[model samples]
Structures are given as C-alpha cells and as structure tokens.
Target: MIKIEDITFVAAEAYKRSGLVLSTDKGYLLESRLAPLARAEGYPSIEALIAAARRESNDRLLWAITEALATHETFFFRDNTPFDLFKQEILPVLSRARGNMSTIRIWCAACSSGQEPYSLAMILEEEKARLGGLRFEIVATDMAPRVLEKAKAGVYSQFEVQRGLAIQRLVTHFDQSGDQWRIKPNLRSMVTFQKQNLLENFSGMGTFDVIFCRNVLIYFDADTKKRILQRLAAQTASDGYLIMGAAETVVGLSQDFAPVEGRRGLYGRSGAAKSAAA
Candidate 1:
C-alpha cells in the first residue's frame, strides 16, 4: 500500500500545480496511473518513485505524475449537445452580432489531443459559405505537453476517430494512414495549440467569442471553480457565450455567467460580467 503521507504529497502537488483536488479516497488512482510512469522512469514501485521525487525535489517527475492523473480521455464532438448548440445557435447569433468583424475566435480550454477544436474546425468549414467570408480562429489549450504534441500531429487511431465522429465527417476531414487517420491540413491549420495552465491568468490570450471549458471544473474545488469561472468571464467578449460540462454548474459559485434558457450547458455573460468588461 502507498503511504498516506505519499498520497497526501501527490494531492497537495496536484492542487498546487493545477488546482486539482484529488481526494484521499481516490488514492488508488495514483497507484493505477503512476505505476506505469514509475516503471518507465526506472523506479521499482510508486512508493520508491515518490520517495525519489521528494528526496531530489524532482519537479519534472512531479509534473509527469500530475499529468498522468489528469483526465485526458476526450474524443471528437464529446457530448453532442454542446457542439450542436455551437453550430445551430451560437454561430448564427455571432454571425449577426459580429458582421462588421473579420473573425470569430473560439477558445477550447483543456483541449486534450485536439479532438474538440478540430471538431469545431470541421463545423466552421461546413458553415463557411453561410458565414459570408468571416474567418475563424480556434485556440486550443492544455497544460500537458505530451497531449499537446499529439494534438499538433493530428493523427488518431481508428478507434479514436470512430468515437463521436460521424462517418461523413471522417471522410471529409481526414485522410486514412494505415490503420490511423490524420486530420487534413486545412482543419489542422484552423487551430493553434498552446500549453496553458488554467490556474494562471489568461489575460495575454485576449477575449473569445466562444469558450468551451467543459468537464474541466469538476476536477477542481468549489473555490477554484469560482476563480476560474470569474477569469473566464473577464476573457469573454461582452456578447459571447460560455459552454461548460453538463454536469458542472456555476449557480452558487459565480455570478459572472447566467445560463441561457432552454440550453443545458450554454451560458451568456451576465450583466455584472459585461459591466466589468466594459
């Protein structure tokens, strides 16, 4: 069994780096996720690995552990409702509201392995004619370098492509490579991937017309969730929308966003947030 102190150390480190609140009850996750890392890093066991990390003050190993614990199991068009809302509702409104502007910018936070942003790119490509020459900028950010590298390459295994991706979309936007599929260059070019820790300030990134921060806040504590939501509000355009995970809500935690009626996970900037942005 891993020592309680070691588990506590991991939980503390995860919180410090990413604001992730790893509960003591879920300590088995450390053993399951970090066991491979320990073996690959030449440690005999997870306990030995943690011992070495503590003894050496190994920031790199600690970061690796945190990355391992982070949930990266995302697929294309995850949870169809949000993407449907983006294409059907969000786009038309933004097109009219920003007709004078040249571009519509979308931010996909915690974009693991590029699927979410790439899915958006495909929708934008399909709607280009309707948009009347309006350009699109998709900024995809994740804190893990390993997933960022995979996202940049734009390659996916057959099973990965099959998940949440329609066959027609697959044929149109990807080229088959052996048993793997690679997202075409046009779709790949639409997104710019960066390593960003959501715990830090996003001021340098500028405002976004749409922000997809789905399924990420559930990992953080309530206070952390409130802080991130407030920052997200500041970085959203006054007329823009925020799409979160269906299971996540900002009801009591924040007043920066108010839900768009009839839309499960869609939110519009509140009056308070708009005033602050002004």
Candidate 2:
C-alpha cells in the first residue's frame, strides 16, 4: 500500500500546478487512475511512480499523469437543454446583432473530446440559410493535449455517438468507419481546437460573442473559480453570453455577470439585455 500522506502531498502539488483540486478522499481515485501507468512504467507502487515523476527528465510522464487525472468525459450535446436554448434563442439574436459582421465567434472553454463544439457546429450548419452568409468560428479549447488530439480527429465510437446525438443528425453528419463515426469535414471545419489552460491569462484568444464553459469549474476552489470566471468575463464581448453548467452559479462570485431566469445554464454580462427579455 502507498503512504496516503505522501500521495496526498504530491496530489495537492500537482492539482495546484494544474489548477485542479482533489480532496483527500480523491487520493484513492488518483491511485486507481495512475495504477496502469505505474504498471506500464514498471513502478511497483504509487510512491515509486510519484518519486519517478518528481525526478523524470522527460516531462511527458507528468503530463500523462495530469491528463489521466483530468476529466475528459464528454459527449455530443451532453446536456440537451443548453444547446436547444442556443439554437432557438441565442444564435438568432446574436446573428441579428452582428448585422453585417462577416464572422461570429464562439468559444467552448473546457471542450472535452470536442463534442460540445462539434454539436454547435452541427447546429450552425443546419441553420446556415437563416444565418444570411455570416461565417461562424468556434474555438474549442482544453488543457489536455491528448484529448485535443482526439477532438481534432473528429472521430467517435458508436457508444459515444449515441450519447446525446440524435440518429438523424448522426446519419446525416457522420460517416460510418468500422466501429467509429467520423464527423463530416464541413462540420469539423467550423471549429478550431487549441490547447489552453483556463487558469492562466486568455487575453491572446481575443473576444468571443459567447463562451460555453459548462461543468468544468466544479473542480476548482472558490478563489480559483473567481479568477477563472474573471478571465472568462474579460474574454467575452460586453453583450456576450457566458453559459455555465446547470449545477454551477456565479451569483456571489462576480458582479460582472447576471443570471438568465427560466433559461438554465445561461448567464450574460450584467449590462447586456437579457436574451429572454429581448
């Protein structure tokens, strides 16, 4: 058995480095996640793996550990309600507001495995005629480079596809390649995947009309969440929407954003007109 104290210390440091938080109870979870990698590396126990990681010159091992611990569990349209609201209410309004602008920008902050942004692309493609020739640019970012590689590939297993993706869209937008479904090139082209750490400054990415940062902040501590939210707010256009997970809220975190009532998972800058009201 590995010393829980040593494991906790290392885990705490690693989480701090990655801007993720892990409770003491999560030590076992981390042990379980890294067991395979440890075995592959010929390390007898978690302690050996930790020591090796601490001294390893490659740096890839540390990244592998972080990537393994980082959550990449996502699917196309994982939550249906938010995407529906985006299609029915948000996009039209944003499109009208942009008017003659050639492009509309969107960002998927914690875009795990690419589903969320790809789903947005599918919706935009479906509504292209109504968009009146406006180009849509979707920036999908995640901290894990491995997951970003998978996302860039735009290929998903049948089980992954069935998870929130409808049959009609699947049939229309994807190609059957053996056991996996490949998202069509056109839809995939709409999004550009990038490796990003949300905890750091995002000023280089420029402004976005909407940012979907769902379900990823639950892992951060309060202060980390506040800093991340502030950076997210700064990256957003004044009237842009900031969509968070349904279970998450920014009520006391910052005064820059206001909640959108009746529309769960939707938030907008305080001074902006409510999508529901508009």
Candidate 3:
C-alpha cells in the first residue's frame, strides 16, 4: 500500500494539470488502477510507481496516470431519452433555422469510445430525406487519446451494439464480421474525433449549435463545474441547445442559460440583453 501523504503532492500536481479532482476517499480507486501499471513496469508497489514517476520530469508516467484516471466507459446511445428529444424537436428546429447553410454542426464534448456521435450519425441518416440538401458534421472529443483511436476505428462487439442501438438501425448502418459490428464508411465520415480538454479555453474550436456534454461534470466540484459550464456557454450559439445528462443541471451553476420546461435535460441560452425599449 502507498502512503497517502507520499503520493498526495504528485496527485495534487496531476489534478492541477488535468483539472480532475482527487481526494483521500478515492485513494483505493487510484491503488487499483496503479497496481496493473506497477506490475507491468516491474515496480514492487504503488509507492514504487510514485517514486519512479517523481524521479525525472519526463511526462510518460504522468500521461499514464492521467489516462488511468480518465473516464472512458461510454457506449452508443448510452441513454435513449435525450436522443429521442433530439430527433423529435432539436433537429427539426436547427434544419429550419440553418436555411441555406447546408451543414449542421454538433459537438459531443466527452465522446468516449465513439458511441454517442455515431448514434447521432444514425439519427441524421434516418432523416436524410427531410434534410435533402443539407450536410452534417459531428465533432467528437475527449481528453484520452487511446479511446479516441478506438472511436476512430468504429468497431463494436455484439454486447456493445445491443446496449442501446435498435435492430433496424444496426442492419442499415453496420456490417457484421463474426461477433462485432463495424459502422459503415458513410456513417463514419460524418464524425470527426479529436483530443480536447474541456477545462481549458475552447475559443479556437468555434461555436456550435448543439453541445452534448453528458455525464462528464460529476467528476468536478461545484466551482470547476461552474467554470466549465461558463466556457461551454461562451462557445454555444445564441439559439443553440445544451443537453446534459439526466442527473446534471445548470441551475445554481449558471444564470446565462434557462431550462427548457417539459424537457428533462435541455437548456437554451437566455437571449442577450433583450433590446431596451427602443
């Protein structure tokens, strides 16, 4: 077992670098993650791994540590309700408002393993006739490069596919190879995956009409969540929608956004300075 005090400084430094909060209560989780890395590296224990990490300024160890801490357990259409709302309400509004733009842009902020964006692609494909002259782009991002690579591959096992995908959509968009289903080339082309850290300024990425930042903020404390939500607000378009996980809400965290009633996980930016009585 590693002494909490010995690794506390390094843990704090790691948290500062990644914006992932760590506390003594989560020590056991760290131990379980580090144990495999320690054995693979021939280190005797978690303490030895920490000492090795501190020996030099090289970031390989730090990368491994951060990767271990990242949450990567996401699947296609993880929750069905939000997707239902998007198909029924959001897409129609965006398609109409886009007019001659010919392209619809969406961002999946913490797209782990690629299921979420791919699910969006299937939805877009289903409505292709309605969007005859329109193009669509889905930008999927995450802090973990390893998972991004997997997402880029667009392959899922039978168990993963059965989780939330409908049998009809599966037949239309995927090809079966043994027990795995591989998303077709056309569907894969609609999504672009990249590495991004949501905690930092994202001004360079440009604004989006819809941002799906689901189930990601639970890891951050209140202050961090507020900061992240503010940054997200700045990057979202005025009429755009922000969809959070069912359990997450922007209430008390932000006043810039207003909840859309009857919609469980939807929010829209409050119009900016509703023009003074001209």
Candidate 4:
C-alpha cells in the first residue's frame, strides 16, 4: 500500500526532475499512474515502487515516473480562435515587417504529439501565396522524449484526428495506414522535432519570429514562470509575437512581452512594452 507520505515524496521528486506541480485535487493520481509503472518494474505495489525510486539513482525509472506525471493532452489546431487570429492579424503584420528578411522561424514550445506545429504548417501552406517569397520552418520541441518520438513519427489514431481537424484537412493531408492516420511527408517535413527542457538553457536554439508557448506556463510556479518569460524575451526577436493559452497571461508575470492590443491570448515584444499591464 502506498501511503500518503510516499505520494507526497513522489510529487516532490517529479517537480525536482521536471518542474510539474501535481494538483492537490487528484487523490488517486499516484495509484492510477504509478501502479502500472511499479508492476512493470517487478515491484509488488506503489509502496515498493516509490521506495526504490527514493533510494537509487535510476535514470530510466526516474524518467518513467516523470513521463507518467507529465500531461500529453493536446489536439490539432486547438482552440480555433488563435489560428484565425494568427492568419487574419499576426501573419499580415509579420509578413510586411519582415519583407526584407525572407526567412522566418517559429518555435512551438512544448508541442505535444505534433498537432500544434502541423497545424501551423497547414496554415503556412494555405497562406503561401500571401506570404510570397518567405521561407518558414517550425521548430517543435517538448521535454518528454516519448511524446517527441510520437511527434516525430507523425502518426495519429482515429480519435485524435477527429478533434479540431476538419474533414477537408484530414483527407487532404493524411494517408490512412491500417487503423491509424499518418501525416503526409510534405506536411511532416515542415517541422523538426527536438527534445527540450524549457527550464534549462536554450543554447543553440536561436531566436524566433513567433513562439507558441501555449498551455505550458500555467503549470509552473511563479519564479520558474518569471525565469522562463525572461529567457523567452531574450530569445524572441524585437518585433516578434508570442501566443499563450486562453487562460494564461503575462500581465504581472514579466514586463518583457506585453499583451497585444485587441488580441486576447497573444503577446508581442514590439517596441517599448507599451501594452504591459500593471
């Protein structure tokens, strides 16, 4: 039997390795997530599992525990409003401003299972004419190696495809394979997947013109969020745009990026941080 003390320790360890804050509300989270992990490693119960995790420097086991805790819940073109905002507003401004520099780079930070970046590719394809002469690539990254592998494989089950993806796009961009759908080579080629820990240094990652860091910062504590925002500010171009989750805000978190005027869930590093709210 896994005691409450063991569950608390597990949560602490998860945070140390990955900065994930386990919700106090999920009472059965440890049992639901760690039980299978324990059984797989030949432990009798969650108690034995966590006992071993506490004692040793087992990198493999440690990662397995973290992965179980990490949420991989995501889908294509999630929250339609943002994509529309991108096409109708952000893209045009960026296109005109970056006319001299024909290359554009977008970083899809914590891009779980490839959906978000691929969604960008589809929009890029659809807007190729309007964005004439511009060359763009998406650098999609996640801390979880397992999810990154899934993203790189570019395969999705039927249920995953049905979420937020239109039939036209599904037929136009994916090929059915057995019981799964595989993203076409052309679309898959537009993104490069890498394993990246957001809490760590972003060396060699370079600056980005647009960054989609949605649904990620909400899980981090305040200090971590501040550090990440500062790093994000340094890595974004002077005139870049950042998109966050609908429920997230940088208002009091960091002064580097301000919420763009008239756009919810969007922030811009455009001159002087004028839109920064107190």
- Candidate with the greatest TM-score versus the true structure: 1
Candidate 2 local lDDT, 200-249, one digit each (tens): 67899999988999998888888888888888889888888988888999
Per-residue alpha-carbon lDDT of candidate 3 for residues 37-72, written as tens digits (9 for 90 to 100): 779778898788778787875488877777777667
Who is ahead in TM-score, 2 or 4? 2
- Better candidate number, 1 or 2, judged by TM-score: 1
lDDT score for residue 97 of model 3:
76
- Which residue runs does candidate 4 get wrong by more than 4 Å? 23-25, 270-278
After TM-score superposition, what is the CA distance of residue 63 in candidate 4 from its true location, in Å? 1.7
Q: Report the C-alpha lDDT of model 4 over 185-233, residue by residue, as the tens digit.
A: 9999999999898988895899898899999999888888888999999
Q: What is the lDDT of residue 56 in candidate 3?
A: 71
| Regions more than 4 Å wrong, model 1 | 272-278
Candidate 4 residue pairs that clash: none
Q: Between which residue pairs do clashes occur in model 2?
A: none
What TM value does model 3 have? 0.91
lDDT of each: 0.91, 0.85, 0.83, 0.85
Q: Between candidates 3 and 4, which one is better according to lDDT?
A: 4
Show how many residue pairs clash in every candidate, following the order shown: 0, 0, 0, 0
Q: How well does model 1 score by local distance difference test?
A: 0.91
Q: Superposing every Cα of model 4 onto the true structure, what RMSD results?
A: 2.7
